[model samples]
Target: MNQLEALKRWTTVVADTGDFQQMEQFRPQDATTNPSLILKAVQKPEYAPLLQQVVAQGKGAEISALMDQLIVRFGCEILTKVPGRVSTEVDARLSFDAAATVARAQRIVALYRAQGVDTASRVLIKVAATWEGIQAAGQLEREGIHTNLTLLFSRCQAIACGDAGVQLISPFVGRIYDWYKKQAGAGWDEAAMAGDNDPGVQSVRSIFDYYKHFGIRTEVMGASFRNVGQILALAGCDLLTIAPDLLAQLQAASGDVPHKLNAAAAQGMALERVHYDEAGFRFALNADAMATEKLAEGIRAFVADAVKLEQLMQAAAV
Candidate 1:
């Protein structure tokens, strides 16, 4: 079997893209979309019709509502391809507003439902892993709206997500790797940090170990992988949302994809259970410079793309 085939035996591979056309070939069990990805897709000539259709239908509705509809449209298309689920992210601008985040998430779910989607099973409302976001997810979960907490970069975030009883948590792998590598500058040793020693890989591993040890029911889906190595290192995660290029590389490569992360082994380790309240969560997140910076940077990047997407919609409306 090719590496992708081998990896699937242990992990549920998810396509991390707004371009649903790319998903059929990879046969990802699930798919994930963010504002940036949606923005990227709508800009393509082939996807132009999708944007125009949404704009034409939305008419004079608020841009925010139209944005939600567009993403839900993408999610609905993605769902037709993947059998399991599709994560549609909330607007990153509401990352810190629990009430607004919850309201927006409910609206997104309502849009999906209007299209006959089984929101509880076939959709995951993706939210940033802010304390407020987690709290918002907890509220959504209570209402039977499953959530995928995204932009998570710390164990504290993971812990909080688990506490929130979220359906899943996407701890970014590549972004963490990027931050550490950039910080190391000249002292970075690629050879030593390539595989198991990779900081990003280690971060997911630590979160995985903790979740397994505590029997946390929230699934961990490692996202934002930079290369095949990071994906391979996390072969046994609950799920790994990978870009199409890396998925293609794995599909082309021939090798044994090892089950690198073992739940039983994680459970065997001596790990203390950790929980975080609002203040504690804030303090913990603030203490981790990498997590703090990346979380903010990720939110800003997504918000910028969301704005760009709105601009495209406005132009299409005219």
Candidate 2:
């Protein structure tokens, strides 16, 4: 079997794209989208019509509402292709605001429900893994809305999300790798950090080990992978959201995708349980320079794309 098929035996392969057309070929169990992915998709020639259609329907509505509509429409389309959930992210600008995050998440879920999608089972509202976002997710979870906590870069963030009783946590793999590699500069050793030793892979492994050790029910979906090796290293994760290019690479490469992570094995390891209150969480996050820098960078990038998406919508409205 190809690596993709082999990997599927151990992990639920999720297509991380806003392009539904690409999802059919890989047959990923779930799909994930952020502002950057959606913005990229809507600019494509084939997807331009879909954006125009959404704009036409909500011609005079608030741009933010129309933006939500467009993303939900994409999510709904993605739902038709995949049998499992689709993660639709909340606005990055609201990442630090608990109330606003909850409100926007509710609106996204409501939009999906209006289209007859099963919001309870088939949707994961993606929120940034800020303290406020985690708190907001806890509130939404109580109301029966599932959440996928994204932008997670630290174990503290993962613990907070698990404590919040979120459905899943997406600890970014590639972004962590990027930060460490840039820091290493001339001292970086590509071979040494290639697979299991990769800082990004290690981050996910640490989070996964902790979750399995504590029997935390929140799923761990490794996101923002830099390559197939990172994906292969995390073969047994609950889910791995892969971009189409990497998915294609996996599909074409024939190899044995071994299960590198085992929950039962992780449970046997010595790990201390960690907890974080509001002040503690803030301080913990602030202490990790890499996490702090990357979190801010990721949020800024997403917020910029969101604004660009708005500009596109406005131009389409005109």
Candidate 3:
């Protein structure tokens, strides 16, 4: 079996893209999209019409409303291709507003329902891992709206999300590696940090071991892979959301992709359970410089793309 096929035996491979056309090629079980990916997709020739159609149909409605429609439209389209579920992210600007995040998540779920989607089973509202976002996800979960907590960096964030009883948490792998590598500057040894020694890989492994040790029900889905090595290092994570480019590379490569992270292995690990209240959560996140900077940077980047998407919708409206 190819590496992709080999990995699937242990992990549920998810396509991390807004371009549904690319998903069929990898045959990922589920798909994920953020404002950035959706923005990138709608700018393409094939997807440009999707934006135009939403603009024309949402006449006089608020632009934000139309923006939600556009994302749900993409989610609906993606659902038709993937069998499991699709993660539609909330507006990143609301990452710190629990009320607004909850409101937006509700609307996104409502819109998916209007599309005849089995919202309860097929949709995961992706929220940032901020304290407010985690609280918002807890609220949504109580209402039977499953959530995927994205932009997760620190173990504290994962602990809080698990406490919130979220359906899943996406701890970014590439961004963490990027931060450490840049911090190391000239002293960074690429080969030494490539595989199991990779900081990013180690981050996910730590979370996985903790979750399994404590029997935290929230699923750990590793996201934002920088290289195939990172993905391979996390072979048995609950799921790994990978970009199409890396997915293609995995599909082509032939090798022994071992089960690197499994419950059995994690159970054998000596890990202490951690619970983070709001104050504790904030302090823990603040203490980690990498997590603090990357979390804020990720929110800003997503918010910028969300604004750009709105601008595109406004232009299409005219």
Candidate 4:
């Protein structure tokens, strides 16, 4: 079997893209989208019509409303191709505002519901893994709105999301790799940290082991992978949201994709459960320079793309 097929034996493969047309070939169980992906998709020739359609449908509505509508439109298209769920991210600008995050998530869910999609089962509101975002996710979870906590970069972030009883947490793999590699620079040994030893892969492994050790019910989905090796390392993660490029690589490659992670192995490993209250969570996140820098950078990047998306919508409205 190809690596992609081998992966399906141990993991639920999720296509991480806003390009719904590209998702059908891989046949991923779920799909994820962020402002960056959506912005990229809307600019594509095939997806330009989708943006124009949402703009046309919401003529005089607020730009933000139309933005939400566009997200749902892409999500609705994705839902038809995937059997599981579609993670629609909340605006990154509201990442630190608990109330605003909750409100936006609710509105996004409502938009999905209005499109006749089963919001409860098929939609996951993607929120950044900030303290406020986690708190907001907890609130949404209580109301039966499932959330996927994204931008997660640390064990503390994962623990807090688990505590929030979120449906899933997306621990970014590639971004962590990028930060460490840039820091190491000339000192970095590519071969030494190639696969399971990779910092990014290790980050997800640590989070996965901790979650399994504590019996945390929140699913762990490794995200933002830079290569197929990282995905292979976390072969038994609850889910892995792979970009279309990486998914294609996996589909074409034939190999024995071993189960590198499993609850049974994780439970037996030596790991301690860490609890993080709000203040503790903040301090923990603050102490990790890599996580702090990357989290802030990730939010800023998303916010910038969101603005660019708005510009595109504005032009389309005219």
Reference-based TM-score of each model: 0.99, 0.99, 0.99, 0.99
Better-scoring candidate (TM-score), 2 or 4 = 2
Model 4 lDDT per residue over 142-216, tens place = 999999999999989999999889999999999999999999999999889889899999999889898898899
N/CA/C clash count, model 3:
0
In model 4, the runs with Cα more than 4 Å from the true position are none
Per residue, candidate 1 scores C-alpha lDDT tens digits across 1-318 of: 899999999999999999999889999999999999999899899999999999999999999999998999999999999999999999999998999999999899889889999897899999999999999999999999999999999999999999999999999999999999999999999989998999999999999999998898989999999999999999999999999999999999998998999999998899888888899999999999999999999999999999999999999998
Deviation (Å) of 308 in candidate 3: 0.5
Q: How much lDDT does each candidate structure score?
A: 0.94, 0.96, 0.94, 0.93
Residue lDDT tens for model 2, 177-199: 99999999999999999999999
Which candidate number maximizes lDDT? 2
- What is the C-alpha lDDT profile of model 3 across 188-227, one tens digit per residue? 9999999899999999999999999888899999999999
Instruction: State, as a TM-score between 0 and 1, how close model 1 is to the true structure.
Output: 0.99
